[model samples]
Target: MTLATKITLVRLALIPLYAWLATRYGSSVSAGQPDEPFRLAAMAVFLTAGLSDALDGWIARRFNQHSALGRVLDPLADKFLMLTALIVLCVSPWSAQHKVPFWFAGLVVLRDVLSSLAAWAIWHRHGRVRISPHWTGKVATVLQLLALGWVMLQLHFPPSWIVMPAAGLFTFASGMCYIAEGWRQFHHGPPPP
Candidate 1:
């Protein structure tokens, strides 16, 4: 019921809208009549949701409104939004020309799945799991957002060749870091409170 949590929920609600618009735009491109309005609208919704993520986090920290539900919902919303965008851009025929590379998306998704499983195992064993965010993970997330935005906007200046590879590297590095942490947590038990 906090304002920050409310914003997070709103961001979650935007995911379906974004998916619909992005797929519609893709369909138009596949039909040989690319619709600028659908593309732009999808971009607008994506940006709004992305901005709301930062806003909610800032509000939570600044206003001391952190909650257990917020912690769970924030990451869930992020994963959903990012995964939905990746699938829409990579799998949809409309974005074939400017789609996110399948390899990169696969790496991102695999890391998330492995991380989730690791977390669950730790929780089941220890009754609690505490994972402090790593800088590499944060960098990976920013790179992912940049890559997603680049493909969504169809920007050609920097090129996906540079963007995607960099994102993939960071993602791999972060996944490795998480795997190490998870291993340590599993064997050594959760970190001290």
Candidate 2:
């Protein structure tokens, strides 16, 4: 297997580990007290998984090992990791007060769903694929991580009120960017008669 594929697989493996740690520690916390050991361990796991995201891409680019399979696997790993973390953090006892609102979660899932459908439609009609990560998408991912971290850690440390709204805005912006880009790519180099 290529280095990119290997890196993607490693990243994918980390997702479940991170999610397990998050849910485990987050659930272990008492109603009014923080579970320091579990919280720290979970945070470490989450940070490690997030770091692997950048690490895999760096390794792939550095080794010139980019592949179609890597492209698919890498994003799949990211979406799964983030979505799982968010779900766990939202439901964990530690995050009961700072849970990710259902509307935000719905919007996030809807964005991903629409993007997938757009990609599929493009493939069906044009026999092509576009997987470039946009700046807005990157920002949105960052916002999500920050928000999830805050919610997960809020039992030990109070979080700023800005995170939730910021996350929501970035998520909305990313969705809009994806929709615009998908439309442009679909219609590019075409002249409707």
Candidate 3:
């Protein structure tokens, strides 16, 4: 395995850690335990994991170590972490009672699921599918990270009506962007190899 792969794996490994922290503090905060430490800790884990996501990609490309495995694992890890955070934020004791709409989470996961299926279909047809990460997708990801971070923090801080909608809007917009890209790929066909 390449060093990039190893780093990617490490990032994936951190998902459980992030989940545990979020769940632990989320429950406490939801229960009205008046504890800030767990919430803070969960936030820290989230930021750390997000940083690792960026680092692994940089390392992989900077060292010319990109691989098929890295391509697959990197996106998979991102989806998992993002989804896990959202689910924890929505379901934790605090969020369970005052949760972001379940449809927001549904939108996020459904988009990815549909995109994955499209990509697979293209690949299965022996089409040359170059998985060049799009700039819009990256921007969408940053928005997602920020929105989720804000939502998690709101669990302990002043709850904002804007955060949830902002998250849903950006997530939905991102999904639309991916859907358009997929359509382009389908109609125009993958660029000549």
Runs in model 2 deviating more than 4 A are 30-34, 155-160, 187-193
How should the candidates be ordered by lDDT, best one leading? 1, 2, 3
* Residues 23-83 of candidate 2: C-alpha lDDT, one tens digit per residue: 6676666455556777777778777777877888888889888888887788898898888
2 against 3, candidate with superior lDDT: 2
Badly placed stretches (over 4 Å) of model 1 are 93-96
lDDT of 3 by residue, 17-119 (tens): 8888878886776566746787777778778777888888888889998998998898888889898887776677445434546777777778788888888
Clash pairs of candidate 2? none
lDDT of each: 0.92, 0.76, 0.74
State residue 92's C-alpha deviation in candidate 2, in Å.
Answer: 2.2
Ranking by TM-score: 1, 2, 3
Q: Provide C-alpha RMSD values for all models, in order.
A: 1.1, 3.5, 2.9
lDDT per residue as tens, model 1, 1-193: 8999999999999999999999999899988899989999999999999999999999999999999899999999999999999888887645555888889889999999999999999999999888888899999999999998888878886987999999999999999999999999999899888
Instruction: Give per-residue lDDT, candidate 1, residue 151.
Output: 89
Give the clashing pairs for model 3. 30-94
Q: How many residue pairs clash in each candidate?
A: 0, 0, 1
